[model samples]
Target: MATYDLKGKRALITGGASGIGLGAVQAFLRCGASVAVNDLADDRLTAVVDELASAGHAVVAAPGDVGNPEQAPAMVAQAIAALGGLDYLVNNAGTPGTARPIATDDFERQDEDFWQLLVNVNLVGPHRCTRAAAEALRATGGAIVNTTSIAAFRGGGSSAVYCATKAGLVSLTREWARALAPQVRVNAIAPGLVDSDWMCRFDGQDDAVRMGQPVPLGRTGTPTDYGEAILFLAAGAAYVTGQTLNVDGGLTT
Candidate 1:
């Protein structure tokens, strides 16, 4: 719930239609930033934009499937156009590629197609969005905050492929920080068990209650928790980059 004096700042958040993405959008708006939210082109996108706009927020829609290479560039371009320029890009779009966790021993379930889908959406998608937005980000001396996961380090995600893709993203965050240095900053967030639709897929309401008991914080994460971390990385962490902030309520510890 922290606020910043970001009246003129502009941001584009991929997967901004819901969950952490939506939370970031609201946080940026609360701090007086004009935000462009990106999600797969669908009715949900329209609904979210409308809902936020109705609430008097400076929000615009920039819809496209980040997983589609052919569509990623256009998505970033449209977002930049909508915002006039980009100051921050939150690469938050990702997928688990399954309805539930797939155990490592279930070799048959870890098929090539599952691997391909997860890689395309969770790994390559961020690269595509970042590449497309690099010039504008450099122009504005902006920052990039990628949405990684605790799975990257703990290897306890829905699938091995899911963990691998997040791990790849962590590597990319460092490399991109180096590549985009002296102009733009790049960092990442590794969330633990967030109470979002995505997490519900792995742990339903009942299980989530039981899961929270083990966390040091005694509760699951919320979208606002992630949004605040992202806002810090984007608008306040002037001297920070190439690092992954674990907003996991000490679960990883």
Candidate 2:
């Protein structure tokens, strides 16, 4: 946990209600940056923002569904306005569309709706947010950090569609770096198995003990692990862009 002098800085993190996104929200606040937390309009969003505000951290609730074409840009605009400007945009919203992993050969299960849902949230959603926040980011010379997945690189994921969408995001990250250069830098992180409460759950399997066994580090990653990397890319990493860092506890190695 390196300390960054993020005082007076402002950031908006999508999917900020829980898991890695929540971790990122805390990271930014700890470094003295005002944050606008975005998620679907839900009770968790209210509670998280209220809790941070009560703690005297400058936090705002900017709730909306990134999958929605209209709400995504509107939410980013409103968040940027609320923050007075933006220094960082973390495009962390995404979905696996399943409580358990769908077998790769389960073609019948990998239907049209499943593919579309993954694409909408995991791929197009980031594009929507980045595009909406581009001008503000450019003005401030801010950076964008996208939450991709180790699933983008290899075979193990909830489904084929989920992996494909994340891979698409990797491509977008590179293009966005070029599109916003000399003003804003863009990068991504591909997380390995993480011990977080999200839509993707392993029934009767302990993520730390089961999934951790395969990781070279012999542990599943916590939100803090990925969060630290997110913070670095957003506030630091001046010379880094058009890249995807593997925050996977050496799993990729």
- TM-scores, all candidates, are 0.97, 0.97
Q: Each candidate's lDDT (Cα)?
A: 0.91, 0.91
TM-score quality measure for candidate 2: 0.97
> What residue runs in model 2 are displaced by over 4 Å at the alpha carbon?
205-208
Off by over 4 Å in 1: none
- Candidate 2, residue 210: Cα displacement in angstroms equals 1.2
User: On residues 1-253, what C-alpha lDDT tens digit does candidate 1 reach at each position?
Assistant: 7779988889999999999898888889999999999998899999999999999989999989999998999989998998899999999999888767666556676889989999999999999999999999999999999999988998864688888999999999999999999899999999888887756665578776667778999998889999999999999899999999999999989
Model 2, range 1-253, lDDT digits (tens) per residue?
Answer: 8999999999999999999999999999999999999999999999999999999999999999999999999999999999999999999999888866666556577889889998999999999999999999999999999999998898665688888899999999999999999899999999998887652366544644576877888888888888889999988899999999999989889
RMSD of each: 1.2, 1.3
